[model samples]
Structure formats: structure tokens, C-alpha cells
Target: MHMVELKGVSKAFGDVDAVSNVDLTIREGEFVTLLGPSGSGKTTLLNLIAGMATPSAGRIEIRGRDVTHSSASERDLGMVFQNYALMPHMSVFENIAFPLRVRRLSRQEIERKVNDVLDLVQLPQIKDRKPRELSGGQQQRVALARCIVYNPALILLDEPLGALDKKLREYMQLEIRRVHAELGITMLNVTHDQDEALTMSDRIVLMNQGRIEQQDTPEQLYFRPKSVFAADFIGTANLVECEVSAVNGDRVRVTGAAGAFEVTEVEADVAVGDRVTSVIRPENVEVRAAGDDRESTGSDNPWIEAVVKDSLIVGGVVRHYLTIAGDVPVVAQQANSRSRLLLSHGDRVSLRWAQNDCRIIAC
Candidate 1:
């Protein structure tokens, strides 16, 4: 197995600690994304693993060997940068062939490797074209092809599709996934795009201010965040302040602006009369007619009455901002074409969601 492990890795520049005591592991052939905003140390941590920078503390292991102090070349890693890093004067063929040439492979060997990689990235037809002659997506593919031409132990992509427009960027996400599957190589991607992370990763490492916030599968990170920051960052959430009324066994009653909401036991421990924030994803809140007799499907359902303030068509989903009965607003989402009700801006609505669907996040 070619899994990677970082044991308490830390990096600092002067008084600023870029990466602080971060420990992580990547299983063989798994595609993991390091996700966070700028300066969150995602890129720094990737660089440390790539051997472009040394960790101030902790050890980095590849497969089962210590590679903490190894040089970038010694690490046998394929790296693709945000800038594409193609030689301006070289054609795509020569550019992809450069890595193999560095290892002093014979001319025949270099040509074979370059041709195979170009084919793998679906850029074989453009091999003779220069970087400027190719489209943004094609150039990005060339860069990726160059990285994996030598078949490195792991591939590190640092915002490789950042320069492309939205449509092309999305197309590249799928293309990258296809390449990863074909090669069966462990991929470590650093990106700030939550959707991209959600779309492509087998697991996501959520980073914040030089520390790791949480690490889990994409579904876990999106639905069950461990902190308020994780909930807010992963997607749009309605933050509600609630006063804990009582706790009995696995049930807890919370009084809030929307009304009394009963939440089933989450992973958190709480006491009576404690103020807390409960987060509900917009997509989780169900929107129906205000007067509709919403039969209680289960004992764990939390229901609230709200009015639709506005409905927006965001991509394929309809995002509805709701004004609850008590003047507390919450955002709700519905499938753009899933509902028969013609929801408009000023329509009154009722929202219902199960207790397990809501996450009790700390404010």
C-alpha cells in the first residue's frame, strides 16, 4: 500500500505558525481534498508533504518509510501547480516529456511515456500544440499529464483548475476523477471550493487558521459537522439560538425564536437551561402550504410555520428564504422542479424536519 501519514506536522515562519501540529493519513488510492479558505495552511501542509518545504516539527511518512527530510525529487511525487507551469517555448509533447528526460530515460522511452500520458489525459490529439494554442481545460490536462507521466508514488494538485471559468472548472473536476481512477494513485488536492471538494473527494480535511477542524467523508462533513465553523463553512446553514429546556434520556427540548424544538441526542452533551446554537441545512427544511395538515410521521419531527420571503433558482435547486411565525427567518431549499406548488416570494409556508436531520452546533 502507498498510503501517506503525517505525524504531528508543524511549520512556522518567524513568529507565524503556518501549520500547527497537524496529523493526518491518506489511504492508498484514495482521493482526499484539503479544503479551507486562503491562508488556512492547506497549501503549506501539502507542500510539506511534497517535500518542497520541511516541517518545523513532526514526521511525514510515505507508505511505511520516513520521508520528512527527503528532497522533493526523492519523494517521487507528481505535483501540478495553479499556474500550469508549462514551458512557454515548448510544445505539449516536449513539456510532458521533460520529467522523463530528467531521469535520463532513452529517447524511445521518453516518447513512449509522454504519448501514453497524453492519451491518458485525453490530450493526445493536442500533443503537438503549444500551451498558448490549447484551451484552458486542455492546458490544465497537459499539466496533469506531465505530472503523472513518470508514475510518481503520489499526485499533489494545488488548485490545478482554479484558472478555468466555472463551467470548465466543473468539467475538469470530473476529468481529474477519471484520471485518478485510471491511474489508481493516491491524490492530495488543495482547493478552497466547497463544491469541488464535495464533488471529487473520497474524504475531506477541513482546515481553519493553521489547524484541522475536522476530517471525514464528504457526506459526514456536510451533514454532521463537529463545530459551528464546520457547519457554516461547508454549506449554507440557518443558525438558530436556542435555550435548552430539559434533557430526558435521548431527547432534549429547546426553546428558541421559532418555537420549542425537540432534538434527539446528537454527539454533544448538554444540560438544562444552557444556551446553544442549532444549525439546520437549508436543504433539510421541508416547505409546504401553511394550512396543509402535515400528519406527524414520527415522534421525532420538529415542525415550524414560516412564510416564504423569496424563491431563487440557484442552478438546479430552488432556494427559499423563509420568515417564520415568530419573525425568525430560516433558509429552505427545494428541488426546482420537484414540487407541484407554485411557490412565490410572498407565500406563507410551513417547514418540517426530523430531529436527526438537524445538527446541534455550538455557537
Candidate 2:
């Protein structure tokens, strides 16, 4: 049975619909992320699931029990917010034991659970310190420990790491994943950060304008997006407007500002004369000197002539921005290596990628 299920769930405020007819199922032990831009209904959906807000329509079930109208306190869920939400006057021990105390667990049980969770979060020694005395990361860990100490069936995190710096945020992502792996609890996380969603989620539900655009595993959503929004939102993609010129078996030829290109594994129902957009990731594109012999490349990859507009070495990879067919912009990312062709502004280069690396979505 699924840990959480939503059937046609929606929420509206006055005349604005925050979430609309959304259906989702999260299995036990799965880490699912609701990811999108602000006002895209991701957070609102999370709120509905947490019972902080009532849905205007539809039903919600937690472990097969309908809890659509249940109050937040009655739902038995653990939640972590953007702010630590710790009581400033309370010590870490008190904060972590709050839920257990609320349930009227014996003092001994509360102490045992609190100590275990603090150790699990690797901050057992700081139990006597108040929230104000701890670092931001430590405070966040205390909040997480408090959530897990109660042994709730579901945990909801709303931008829980939003307050941390980039480096600390990245560290917390790994830390959260470790905790989830150890506990095997169902987690529903809300965030507008795509990188965090990709790094932590077993599955991601990409939402937009009050509805789910796509839900799939990280690799599937990144490599096989079904819509333009999905392609653009998940990562950096070069979406070129084109028209289908011909179709040969699984390959389709498209003509656009970048010139003629062939795409394989056409999943969308596209045919000749149909307008489409070619979605290709920057890393999938390969760059070479324009003067290199085409035949010598020894591949059927379709090549486009472009002039290097800019280049930046980002750590271990070089990002090359180019102009194709005048105003059309394209980017290629290549590993920084000895044999990589170096290109500068105004340098002419040939860009090519495997036919399978590109996908088409009907415009």
C-alpha cells in the first residue's frame, strides 16, 4: 500500500486556485520532492498533505486511511520548516523530546528516544545547549532530530535548508539522504531548488501553474522530458525551434535556425511538416575545430557551424557559448582535458551530438 495518496486534490484561496485536480502516490520509504518555481503550487500541495490547509476538492489518504479533513495535530506527521522553528528558550533535549512529551511518553522513553535521535544526527553532545547557542547547521539538525524522534510514518520538509549557505546546504542534502536511508521513512520535500531536488529525491513531481507537469525518476525526467517546461526547468537545455523536414524509421530530420539536424528515439507523435522543438542538453553537444574534416570525424552526428561567443572554465568543465545561424544561441559543455579543443570569442567551431542525444517535443 502507498504511504500517501492524493486523489484529485486541490486547494483554492478566494478566486485563486493554488492546486488543481492533482493526483499523486508516494510509496513507503520513498523520498519524493515537489519541485517548481514559487507560486507553482508545490508548497501549497505540501501544505494540503500536511493537513495545515484543507483541500477545496478531493481526498487524501495516509496509509489507506482517508485524512482529507483531519487536523494537522491529528494526522501524526513530522514537519520541518524553512526556519528551524525551535523554541529559543528550550534546550536541544527539550526541543527533540517535545513530540514524545506531547504524546505523554514516560520521561525515560523521551530521554532514550531523544538521545538516540541526537546521535543519529551526529550531535548528541550538544543536547544541553539551547537553540541560540548552536550554529545554523546544528540548529537545523536539531529540528530534523526532533521530527524523527517521534517515529512518524511520514515527514514533510518545506525548504528546510533554505537558511543555510550553499556549501552547508549541499552538506545537509547528503545528511538528510543518510537519515532517510537509515530510517526508511516516507519523505515529501518541497523546494524550488532543482539541484536539491535532483540530488535527494528518488522521484520528482515537477509542478507548474497549479498542476503537475511531470513526475518521474531523476534520470528519466532529465533525459526524457515530455514537455518544453519539463526540459527547461529540470536543467540547462538548448531548446531550438524547428520544423520536422523528414522522418526515417526512428530518426527525424528537423530544420531550424541552427540548420538541419537529425534526432533519434522520437517519442512524441511528430511527422513531416509539423513544428517542433529540439531539446538537447549542453553536455551532450561536442565541439571541434571548424577546419576539421567532417568525414574524418567518423560519426553520423549532425554538425552545425557556429561561432564561439564566450567560454568559461567552470571547475572541471568548460562551458562554451556559441551563436548558430546568426541569432540562435547554443551551449556546449566539455570536460577540461589536454586533448579538448580550446575555443575563444569569434572562433569558428563545429558542434555535433549523437542523434540519440536529442529529443523532440511538438510545439
Candidate 3:
């Protein structure tokens, strides 16, 4: 059975629609992430499924049962929020065991379950300590332990790691992935952090303006986005507007203001002669002095001449911003190494990329 299903679901506050007609299904044991910007309805969608809020229209089901009108508790699901909502006065053991006690489990059963979860969270030693005594990561784990101790059918996370620092957040990303692997639990996570979504989710549901723009595996979403928005949102993308000049199965030739180019063929909502955008990552682009001997010469290798507009060195990567076709802009990133020359502003350069690395998407 599908772990959770939403068909034609939407929610609105006054005239502002929060979630628009979203149709989605999650299979058992899948980790799905709802990702978008601040106003993009990801949190609202999570609330709809958790029964924290009712949808203005359509149905929601969990495990083949309709729960559109059910209360959050009646849905038999557990939620972890951004705040790590642990009781300040309660001991870690009591916090993890509270739900089990409410369920009327025997004393021995509660002890066993609480200990097992504490161990699972790698916090067995802190069971006697109060929530405030633990570090942020530990408290987050304790909150997670409390949610999972009762073994709910589904686990919902709403930016569970948002409160931690970058280092701790990255650590907890793997920690949560490890826990999910061990338990084989179906998880639905809501977050605006694309890096977090890309790092942990099995599939990412990209939301835009209260609507689902695309849902796909992380690699697909990054390398084969279906629209200019998806291409730009998931990561850094350089968009070149072009019109289809030729199509030959795996390769497509297009002409744009940046000049004619060839890219990998993808399913286009529009066909031949239609305008499309070519998406390429900065890392995929090769930058060198104009007419450099390293620039390949072939019908398959298309290169454009651009003048360096600006340059910045971020960590080990040198990012060069260039303008081509008069005003059209593109970015190229190169490793900061001895062999790589840093381009100065107004320096003439050639930018080239593999045809396979260029993705064509009609927008």
C-alpha cells in the first residue's frame, strides 16, 4: 500500500492559496522531501497531511485509509518540528517514554522500548538528564527518539535540523539517514534547504508558488530539470535562451543570442522551431583564454567568446562571471589549482562545455 496519498489537495487562508491542487503518492519505506522557498506552501502541505490543518479541497490518505478530516493524533503519525519540542522539566527517559505510558504499556515494556530508542539515538548515557542539559543535536535526537519510540507508521519531519549550526546540521543529516535505514521507516520531510533535501531525500518534490513544480530523484532534478525554474532553483544554473535549429536523437542544435550551440536532447513540451533554454552547471563549463590551443575544434564542440565581468574565489573554486552576445551572462567555475589561470575583469575568454552536459528544457 502507498504510505501516504494526496489527490487534488489544496489549502487557502482567505484568498491566498497556500497549497494548490497537489497530487502525490509516497510508497512504503520512501524518504520524500518537500522543498521550496519561504512562501512556497511546503509547510502548509505538511500541515495538511498531519491533520494540523484541513485542506480547502480534496482528500488525504495514509496507508489506504482516508484521513482528510481526522485529527493529528488520529492519523497515527509522528512529527518532529524545527524547535525540537522537548519538555524542559522532563528527563530524557520520561520524554521518550511519555507516549508509551499514554498508550498504557506495562512498566517493563516502557523501559525496554525507551532504552532501545535511546540506544538507537546514541544517547543511552543521557537518559537520566533533563532536556536542557543536552546539546542541540542531542536534544534533537531525543525529540526524534520520543517520536519513534512508539513506532508510528509514518514519520514527518518539519525542518528538524534547522536550528543547528551548519556542521551539526550536516552531521544530523547522516545521522537521520542512518536511523531511517535501520528502521526502514517511511519519512516525509519538509524543508527549504535544497542542500539538505539533495543530501538526504530519496526523491525531492520541488514546490513553487503553492504548486509542485517537479518531483524526481536528486540527480535527475539537478542534471535533467524540466523547466528554467527547476534548473535555477535546485542549484546554480546558467540559462541560455535558444531556438531549436536541429534535433538528432540524443543531440539537439539550437541558436540563441549567446550563439548557436548543441546540447543533450530531452523531452520538450514544445517541438522544433520552439524556443528553449539550455541549462549548464558552472562546473561543467570550461574557461580559458580566447582561441586557446586547448579549445577543441569540431562541429560537436561549440564554444562562445565572453569577456570576464567579475571573478571571485570561494574556497577551492574560482568563479568567473562573463558576458556574451553583448549582455547575456554565464558563469564558469574552475578548480583553484596551479594549472588554472584566474581570469581578470575585462579579459577575453572562451567558455565551452560538453554537448552531453548541456540540458535543453522548454520553458
* Number of the predicted model whose lDDT against the real structure is largest: 2
**Candidate number with greatest TM-score:** 2
lDDT of 1 at 262: 79
Report clash pairs, candidate 3: none
Whole-model lDDT, candidate 1? 0.87
Candidate 3 regions with alpha-carbon error over 4 angstroms: 248-250, 269-272
Q: Give a tens-digit lDDT track for model 3, residues 1-363.
A: 999999999999999999999999999999999999999999999999999999999999999999999999999899999998898998999999999999999999999999999999999999999988999999999999999999999999999999999999999999999999999999999989999999999999999999999999999899888888999999899988889988777678888877877877565744579888888899998876864767466755666788998999988988999988859899998898888876788899887888888888886
Q: Return the candidate ranking by TM-score, descending.
A: 2, 3, 1
lDDT of 2 by residue, 99-189 (tens): 8888999988888889899999999898999999999999999999999998999999999999999999999999999999999989999
| Arranged by lDDT, best first | 2, 3, 1
Predicted structure 2: lDDT:
0.92
Q: What is the C-alpha lDDT of each candidate?
A: 0.87, 0.92, 0.91
> Which segments of model 2 are wrong by more than 4 Å?
294-299
User: In candidate 1, which residue ranges exceed 4 Å CA deviation?
Assistant: 295-302, 325-327, 338-340
> Model 1, 16-50: lDDT tens per residue?
99999998989999999999989999989999999
Which residue pairs collide in model 1, if any? none
